[model samples]
Target chain A: MNTINQYYAGLDMGSVSIKAVIISNQKITGWALIPSGGNYKTAATTVMTQALAAAKIRREDLCGIGVTGLGAQSTPFDARPMSDISCQARGCHVFFPSARTLIDIGGQFTKTAKITDKGKIADFLMSEKCATGSGRFLQVISRILQVPIEEIGELSLTSQHPIKFSTNCAVFAESETISRIAEGAKPADILAGVHKAMASKVNMLLKRIKLAPDVVLTGGGGEDAGLAKAIGQIIGHPILVPPNPRLTAAFGAACLTMETTSG
Target chain B: MDTQSQVKTTAVKGTDTAREVRPMVKDIYKAAHEARENGKKVAYMMVASHYDEILRAMDIVPLPTENYAGLCAAKRDMDRFLLRAEADGYSQVLCSYARIGLGFDSLRKELGHIPEGSPDGGMPLPDMMIGSSAICDPRFKWYQATSRYLEAPTFSIDVVAPPPQADLNRVRDYYINYQKEQFQGLIEFCEKQTHTKMDKEKLWEAIRLGDKAWQLWYDIDRLRVAIPSPMPSQDHFSIMVAGHYYTGTQKAVDFYQKLYDEVKYKADNHIGVIKDEKYRILYGGGLPPWHTLWIFNYFESFGAVFAIENVYRGFDPVQVPSHVTDPVDFLAWRTWLRATAYHEKARQNSGNPTVEKLLGIIKDYAIDGVMFHACRSCRATTVGQTHIKTELGKYCDLPMMQLVSDMVDLRDYSEAQWKAQIGAFIDALEARTDQE
Candidate 1:
């Protein structure tokens, strides 16, 4: 039997968020999510320590470290830095072997990965250059309404008559949103419309990767019911969203740690 | 006009020297006279000076492609040629220029395309071609694919950027020499096609004139980005179209000199939006879509003036050698190097893996935030955006926004969601400024 004594760490350094997960001897240990806040280095260090604390493990105990995501190669930890696509695909595949597609929509970037049964990326797509249709985009609209980020999904689900906003430039879209408000467009409808736009963006991304079935929605924005429904409507198929979508990456990272340590 | 009256409508618009179709009354008469005398068909396409070397070498008269009715008229053709443009990641998330190029490509094909060429007229497409992929990779693939159909010979000049760690100017100088060789090779190709030896003296003379024209614009460009923004986008856009053809001719000198005169006049008289411009964002590479003026308006709302773009600016930066000096050789020399110099510099910079210089750029430009676009397949620009972002974080407290979209293909953008991201980015900028 494996001793389960060895420890491993996985760090995902992103534009707006930092996530870390720790595993001790092939069992899911614990995870941490913190604001990257434009400081990838600091965010990395902080998240590592936080994960250690959550798992009740010592940093010295970590035997191997694996980092992934946008800032993966830039983290302070000495480990093999993999592309975000590989990490997400590998992380997601462990829980569900049948899952062929993984959609990771973070606060800043959205990545859609096509995973094989062997946990290798056959192909992938990402929305890293532009932040439109991303989670932070909704943060902006929600802030204007002075609502909490957590509440947007529920509110969007309740909206009637989806309000359509013209333009793809975020700067202009915000201004257009003001037009929607001026036109007495319900916030729910406007949110639904925004959700529809996101759906379209994701649909386009999926089409490129051949639109893999058994798609799993992960990341911060994955929890949004409206966005999932919108995406479902566009892809013309039912999609699965992991519970507490925001914690999915960390969970995946935690699982990554377990795989590395046991081996 | 009937709703679909498909009379021969000239699709040429804007100032793209590569695609513009101005019926030169005299040139037409001359080509007609020559063709009539020789019993040959007369046709021609005017090319920008930058690419003039290639088109001329191929014995093709290159004409600048323009965008008049839309911000970018070439979007359709580019889209058609590159069916999976967005999927392939050739465009950055915000590269609307690529999108516009698609339009131009689409509209022009309807009227039997004009190949870039002669000061006289359209290129006599005999059945073979060769060119460079320096500006982009798609054109290389496009030409190659076209050749597959026509059985035309095509050669691509792969661009190599200098190592960022190496001497920047030295790298530029090196590429200049290489460009000249490529240009000469192209010239030889043209000679073979025309069945005539090009007078070295005339070619050199053309080069000398082209060098002057290119230099004038670069010099003018350096001065255009004043603290009080000296130029509007409309003028900038037009100047770029004209500037493309100025690298190797009397045309460069004339157009740039006139541009300088206009800009100097405006700057001296304080004629344009030059005061209290809070932020100056580098428009960066690719096309900015007029269809989405709201994108610019978003920045303008935050008092951010997109001062200058490298793409629209064209290949104008240079030192104009004396007129007495050999000019064509100089242009050919530089053209070879331009393809690879910037990439080499970026590679060199990343070798040591430090963000100090990137940080300095942020400070020098007064850029409170960095927006590193992750273009889908433009390995040249988007290869290491995330890495750059990490390095950038080391240097300053600026918020970095990475937006996603296909720069060239229009069918790829998610209209509403893209707007959402930009809106958030502006709000972040505004919030940052307010805090400051």
Candidate 2:
């Protein structure tokens, strides 16, 4: 059996960014997140190297590696590829043991996963055929509003009277948002409207699975206070947000590596 | 033609039923072509009605409309036909199989001949159409559309849903009698259309053969209860083609018997379709995305095998009794049974019938998980699927995933999304197994 000093790595090659996490003795030692920029392989390698350097661990010392997310299968790594659902469940369970549901809003997809008490996935629903309810929708809104994607979430929270967006489609919503801007709508209100549209889509997915508490939000959009507020408002309950939401799937992947290798 | 050479096998080897039945499907298509060239009367029918025997009894070549749609989808050539249908004012929201069928028929009618890219030179134009009101309303409407286009006579069997809190014993006689009348009407129509008399003895023999084949199929399904599941779910696609298209023939019995022997042999030898099978899944709800059956091969690569599909179990002996002595009564009873099986099973389980049926199969097959295909074009199958999934959670805590795709429309399918969802499901199942 491997000793406690043994290190493991997990890579999450998401549509928007690549994240890596290094763990030793079941604790996260280092983590890194970088823009995927349509080059997942390079981003994966760069993040892994940075994460390993942060953890002060040698590559050979790693016992196993786990990969998850969009580019997981194609990433240049000799690692076990796992589903983001399992990784997210495991990763969130480590921080929020009471979490029964995990909502992950990535750049190109949104997933609502029901987690068992043992941190395994019981069921999950992923966005289908379109990117309207995902982080990509927020990116489109940000590009139209000329606001930084990261800052839009905080700006949305300041909206007092958010205008309603008629369409849930990203392309149509973009045109609607522009029309709203031309009509002198506040940027915060437009961002808030986008959050509301995203929340409605997420709520529809969550209803399908019948959300169980405590609901924990993770992924790129999980860290957005505005989106979470919108979801919380719609669901009629506050949600738990883990620290470094983008790294949770990677962390879970690393933890899985240890469990699989040790067994 | 070398029949063996014509049968295409996947990289992931399928059960004997799949291997033999695939060749039979090719022959069926070839026979249909020959029948058309010889000016034999051909009848287009929906799969749910169990009218193949009736057609065969009248010496009419039976062409299953949905099966042909599946062929077009599998060949990845459904888009042109679908677009043609859409251009002709058929809603994209209509059942994809209907769209493909309607589109193919319309395109052929316009060209005044089978177009070059038509799948299997397109299905032979129908002299008549037999439709049922059982499974989907669209099926009967689709048949009606085709009948009008072909200027052919159409016979529809009215399969009424059982009343709420209905006892099958009390309602069985009423339905059987009504169905018997319908069967007589169909026979009369066929006799007049084909200029031939109804041969009762030939019909009885065909029904007997069909029952025997269904019995063998039931046995084949039972064999999947074995650990490692000797039968692969994808193989069912080919096997069921025979079931749907050739139910009342000696060929059906022969195909099932050979398939039964092969699956039984594998079970006895402890040989699984997938090596090191770790997870067994039951696929329920909606038709499989015919274009991407390789998804089964992908799952098998992860040591996951789909043990059963609900649609494959549609004609199981348990659902329809196999020991009937009267051919007319047998056909009537079979139709009534098939129509009510879903509702009755659901009533018994106190859940959605589709889900309840899936749960029963899961227990019988020792399935590790459940996957529901939420086909965009198949509202009848997909409606209340979420309710079924939730209710299933009450009976057992098995992990479940719903994949969204259309049965024939490849445009609605997102391969990346499917992979991610299914990959996660397999991972969860593996984790549960490890925990145990």
Candidate 3:
């Protein structure tokens, strides 16, 4: 067994953001999140530094590290590059041990993975060359609506009637959203429609993998209440979004480091 | 955080025989050019065209335009041709090989010569064209479209490969009769185009040599079932050029003979394609993406090797038995056999033939997972893969992944995206094995 005081770190260098988590004795001790900007190596270093400070530990105290997500391979860190899918599955299992399926809508890609009872990925489906089913879709809409991404979800919930989007393409939908605004449609309605549109694409991926429950949603998009609500409504099941939904992959990476060291 | 060493990259080593055979592909196009220069007739044909032997027998150079298109894409020189086709109102959704071939032909006609920077010195204009119904609907239409550009006449042959569960015993004779007529019609067409009568002795000799090459290829493929597979599909793709295009010639027979010897020696010594073979994958369907075949090596970095793939598998078991002395009769039997062998094998097992064959391959090859690369440009290979995936789940608990990209269109592929997916898939395979 690992000593309770021995610490480990997991970092998810995502396309849009970098998330870092520190763990000791199987519990998360500290975590940090920040925009990735253009330089992932710098973002990774900064986020890990912040996470270590939050944990009240120096870098020398860490026993192991696991890195995941898009920038994993390029990160200048002494870490084993882990699969984002496996990391996501492990992270979901930490909070919801019974999670059989995990849907992670990240900044640039969406993934649906079937999780084994032991929190390993059994199989998975991912969005290919498309932004319609990802948090990037939300980012695109946020820019067009002139609303901060954090506020799009709550504002969407306040809509009386959400507009129905005709196209699922992000570029085409951008022009469509502008047209709706010019036609006197409410911002909340357009935002709500975008959430529904994103949910539809997610639903298609879920169906292909033959979604099983209890389902868990994680990643940057899971932070959006509007999208979660839309997905739950469309899939006819409640979605369990863990605390700090964006940090699960990092948490999973941390858990993996502990397992590798102890085993 | 501390700095670590960069990711180590490993390149998949293709066999020396396969490597030697690859350069011969360029010579094929060159031979066509030389043949046309010397005033010998040439015929543009699809890969599935049933008349390569007839054309070779007639001394007409078989210019496999589809193979040339793939070569262009492999060389990363197909954009100009593809752009020309798109500008000429060809849909991007059509088979990219067709688009490249049509675009190349249109450009050549406009330039009154081969386009500058064309791969392999460019394919020569053909005196005639031959298409087949076996591959996909586009197979014939693609040739018919090119025929207009060359002012050449086109001939089409039909092949009816039925489902695995179909009653082959009852329909076999009728199918063979139809196929024999098709082969006869093709020979007559060649006779008229080349102004040469069909030589029975030459045709018979071609059939005998083709049968020998097919037998050798089948033997070579079976060698892959060895632990630490002696050959990877990358090598298989390269070496298949002979069996595919030059089946009737002694050159193809010689190539396969050398390949079989090399593979046998490696298999007997327990030599694998990679040093540490962890997971054996079954590339279930779809032609390989030409430009990024290095992705196979990408899988190798994870200690995973594609041990076998259904597509580009060895020619359907040789149907020409020793007693088969007639050339037309042999071709008819071989064509019919190629169309029905998988289905016939599946009928013996009582399940979906394609799925049953895949399951059989998993057991035979000791495959840990399956990958179906659903090429966007070719519907024939892409369609029915979803159904196969669903059915596969009913029998085995293996991990399966489907990747989407075009076989010839690099624009449809993203290296970053493929790496991420492949990384995740390898992790899943690891997890599955660890639990087992």
TM-score against truth, every candidate: 0.50, 0.92, 0.95
Pairs clashing in candidate 3? B164-B343
Best-performing candidate as measured by TM-score: 3
lDDT of 3: 0.86
What DockQ do you compute for every candidate structure? 0.03, 0.65, 0.74
10 residues in a row with least lDDT, candidate 1 chain A = A247-256
Candidate 2 lands at a TM-score of 0.92
lDDT of 1 by residue, B61-100 (tens): 3423222222222212333334433343444442333333
What residue runs in model 2 are displaced by over 4 Å at the alpha carbon?
A1-5, A26-29, A52-61, B1-11, B147-151, B167-173, B318-326, B341-352
lDDT of 1: 0.56
Q: Estimate, for each residue in B336-372, the C-alpha lDDT of model 3 and write its tens digit.
A: 7776666755666637778877888899999999999
CA-based DockQ, model 2: 0.65
After TM-score superposition, what is the CA distance of residue A96 in candidate 1 from its true location, in Å? 34
Model 3, range A116-231, lDDT digits (tens) per residue?
99998889999878888678889988998899999998999998899999997999999999999999999999998998888888898899898999999999888889989999
Q: Is the docking of candidate 3 incorrect, acceptable, medium or high quality?
A: medium
